[model samples]
Target: MMNNKKPEVWLRGELPGISTLLQPAAHALLQSKEEVFKYTEGFPEFLLWKRPAGRASVGFHLQHITGVLDRMLTYAEEQQLSEKQFEYLRNEGAEIPEIKIDHLTQAFTEKVAQAIDIFKNTAEEKLTQKRTVGRKQLPSSLIGLYFHAAEHSQRHIGQMLVTISVLRNQNN
Candidate 1:
């Protein structure tokens, strides 16, 4: 007989207990994986869809999600993002140049790994620090960064999925 065990859900809907500072990061990391899987599943070959009418391909969007996570991680660490990162957001492409589908997937994976490490290693005191993005500023608490990363990925993942569907239909 085949084993039929189901995968356990990785995140909780309710807020974490007051004692845990890293829970938000943990939650966001899980959500990121879900988003990545949703966007990339069914047709890996479809990642090649770069529309003449659109800005970037599905691969570029994948790279962008990781790129934004890296920015949020910088904010979590109380470090201002560099001009290069700002340029990436404004320009809308890979921060790490010459990115292919494999490279984007790797970058996204690395971002998640870094996120987990930061959450695990950071002191509670550091989590309460302030972070700024140009004129807008917010506390660097785990919740803030966690929601930021997750919500940002959610928005982009939706875009990518829709784009993938359109591209797949167009190509066929």
Candidate 2:
């Protein structure tokens, strides 16, 4: 029997220029990018909007992964939503017929790239700086926000994988 697990990203080594304080978040982001595409590959396009037992559609999970990363990383910057970012947030799971899986994945990949840039430049001292979240003005530190971003992204990735497994298995 073959052992199929790939080595975890954190074990692979240090990421150069990414702040040591932000290392775990960087690893999580890189790992998230890999696992998301693996689970979503060749997922039936016809069922992109289909949900099992009224759970979120695969498309929504895909979109949410990207949108949440964008929003959370923005908050980590001590910023509020931009008009366009707000617009994206407002439509997190709305089903649009013409959108394809690649579009969502592409958006997510781009967001991860931007997030890495943010991680690279964030000062070590700023990890403890306070920031606000959402319109509710909930308080969080820079490190808290980064931790949440990593966890939240993985949370949605788990949801996406479960949804994909359900859908794909049903098809098979």
Candidate 3:
């Protein structure tokens, strides 16, 4: 007879509601950060901004993702965010730096690691508490915020790939 009891698992000193799902999602997001850097290797900064007129350069999209992740991490840690970042969190269109492709890649990697470390060290129970991020109220659960970060990162990664391909084609 098969046992009906659920297997016990823990992360960050607490058991995640869906530990199995969260672990792999976190790993995949981390991998994507590396992949984005690898994808743009040796590419010229000019190409990062050489998109069709009225379109955001690949650089802008990447920087946006970095800012978003940083914002979420700040909220998760209950830390104060920059005045600019706070405005961005409240509004849809926020100004972010025009990051060079290479530098943005490095920044993304570093931010990802920092966010992951914060998430990993947080206790399981703490993951669910709601925290005020900047001025926007958000649920305190780290898991939810982690998921948001991963999904947001993935979306930008996809955009970066498309932008790169378009720029490469334009070059040829």
Supply the TM-score for candidate 2: 0.93
Candidate achieving higher lDDT, 1 or 2: 2
Q: How many residue pairs clash in each candidate?
A: 0, 0, 4
Q: 1-172, model 3: which lDDT tens digit per residue? A: 9896433212233324335445754665676686686678877776766655556577766777778888878777777788887665454222333556667778778888777676567666776777665456644566677777778888877877877877888788
Task: Give the Cα-based TM-score of candidate 3 against the true structure.
Answer: 0.73
User: Which ranges of candidate 1 are over 4 A from the true structure?
Assistant: 1-8, 11-21, 34-38, 41-49, 52-56, 94-98, 124-126, 135-142
Evaluated against the true structure, the overall lDDT of model 2 is 0.88
Q: CA lDDT of 70 in candidate 1?
A: 86
Shift of residue 154 alpha carbon in model 2, Å: 0.6
Sort the candidates on lDDT, descending order: 2, 3, 1
Q: Which of 2 and 3 is the better model by lDDT? A: 2
Q: Poorest 10 consecutive residues of model 2 by lDDT? A: 86-95
The residue pairs in collision within model 2 are: none
Scored by lDDT, the top model is 2
| RMSD of each candidate relative to the true structure | 4.4, 1.6, 8.6
* Best candidate, TM-score: 2
Computed on alpha carbons, the lDDT of every model, listed in order, comes to: 0.66, 0.88, 0.68
List candidate 2 segments past 4 Å from native: 1-5
